[model samples]
Target: MMIDLSRDINLLTKFSIFSKFPLDHLEHLLNCCGAYYKSYEKNEIIYFQGDDINFLCIIISGSISIEKIDIFGNNTYMLDFYSGNFFGEQMILDTPSISPYTYKCSTKCKILCLPFHKKYSTNNCKNTCDCRLLFRENLLNQIAENNLLFINKLEVLSKKNIREKIMTFLINESEKCNSNKVQIPFSKSKFADYLGVNRSALMRVLSNMKNDGLIELNNKTFTILK
Candidate 1:
């Protein structure tokens, strides 16, 4: 679909990778990367596990989920990416790479797709272009940030019980948001998926936690009372 490039570019500039780029250079880089935008409706699958992955994607609006579906068709939520966040980096560099998880839109959204090994990026690695160099550094930073988030999820999963898991996850969220009261991107069911727990059990634990005075819950926002 057609988009207003100026408006779209402005939106992208909010991210550090593109923030320092001059308008002209950014446009050139987009052209060199063969960047394009696509729209998805809520719950639409953007990519499935094992699907060929040829591009990196950034969310322009709305949210996306990285998920794993088991043989029995049960899905586990792995991560959420919101506006200005990107994914598909892990497989983007390999020849004939395949997706490791399913990517689904959590809301009606727009995504920017760019080939991993594009002209601008490739040339920048070999030569000196201030804009491209800055972009590379920012891209690497983004990948590292994703890795840290994965580590945090792993920490949450390491807890043995549902209560411990919930506490760990919420504590991590509190730290990330720098507030005791934190907002979760997922609904109860989706949060259960992320925790790899049954929804009914998750709800029960949350109720118990609330009663124990350990946390105060109001819909998606949880305030750690401890």
Candidate 2:
């Protein structure tokens, strides 16, 4: 699975983390790495809970669900990743016995897998080279973002009931859309998963919101009334 390094480097440069790295460094990494392109059908498992981690996966297109499964086989979702996001970095630092989670394609996905040599030992810490610094900065940014998201979810969940959570999510989404009319980018099931609620609860909340005259919903389209 050979790739044109120049082309891929150019595409990667548009990503926030990789953008900070000089193109030369990315090109160098590309040269040192072997890449493969693969696609997965919707809901397909890209890697299992304890699969051998041999490569880092970068999303080229589409989305993936990162999930963790306990020994009892109960699953909890971690996140949904879109294009330009990388996964499996934890594997780079952990032993084979300490597998963290599984990565599954929520939708059809295209990914670039960069296989690393068993003994590759270049630390991409912030204080190192520009490329390494970029990597560290990006990682820190993701951590901060995730922390904020966690806090927001907690706050929402602490509300009196599901109605409040639904209203809050709608208000936030409306603001993000820059208009009262907003179309949810994901399905109700995905929204339920994100809010840590059941689909029936979400539907009930939406119905309650509509009855309260706070919003109007037509299929996936929602209009928040001021």
Tens-digit lDDT string for candidate 2 (1-226): 5667756777877876566667787766555554577888999987888887777778888998878787898887755778877776654444453336788898899888866554234343223455545555675676565466556656766777777777777776676668888886578897887677899988988888899888898988998874
* Predicted model with the maximum lDDT: 1
The Cα error of candidate 2 at residue 214, in Å, is: 1.9
**Model 1: runs farther than 4 Å from truth?**
69-74, 90-96, 116-128
Q: What is the lDDT of candidate 1?
A: 0.82
- Measured by TM-score, the strongest candidate is 1
Cα lDDT tens digits, model 1, 29-105, are 67656678889999999889989777788888899988987899887789888888887775444344678789999
Compared with the true structure, all predictions reach lDDT values of 0.82, 0.71
Clashes of 2: 0
User: In model 2, which regions exceed 4 Å deviation?
Assistant: 70-72, 92-99, 118-129, 158-160, 171-182
